[model samples]
Target: MPATPNSFSVLSHPSLDQSGGGTLSSPVTRPVPLVESTDLLRGSKTVGIMHNGSLYRLQATKLGKLILTK
Candidate 1:
């Protein structure tokens, strides 16, 4: 079923802090898809993620698993 306005509002609203402080700010204001794993590994066994001027390797193993290495 599609998400209702009430449900969406609750999910997007701030929550009370359990630490007895105050309501915690909600960080997620909107939904966004960063990337899909299947899309990244499509037609390939390895993909790279660039960070801090470095390339990190994400590989699909023979056992049908994934590994990320710096």
Candidate 2:
């Protein structure tokens, strides 16, 4: 199902906090932006992403998998 406008997926990463003394019990929640595959592909099977000074290729395979290459 598609996500609702107010709904999203969240990921948590655990980190060590020396200030709290062995405090890795609580995870840190960070919001990651979600993008649909169709939106990225936009009517094509491949798209280019420019990061830093390099270009990366994101391609959708025939088997419905994605590949990223530098």
Q: Estimate each model's TM-score.
A: 0.48, 0.63
lDDT of 1 at 4: 48
lDDT by residue (1-70, candidate 2, tens digit) is: 8878755654443333434555555554555566888899998999999999999999999999999999
lDDT of 2 at 60: 98
Best by lDDT: 2
Q: In terms of TM-score, which candidate is strongest?
A: 2
Go through the candidates in order and give each one's C-alpha lDDT: 0.68, 0.75
Range of the 10 consecutive residues with the lowest summed lDDT in candidate 1? 9-18
lDDT by residue (1-70, candidate 1, tens digit) is: 7874334523332333344445555455555334556789888999999989999999999998999999
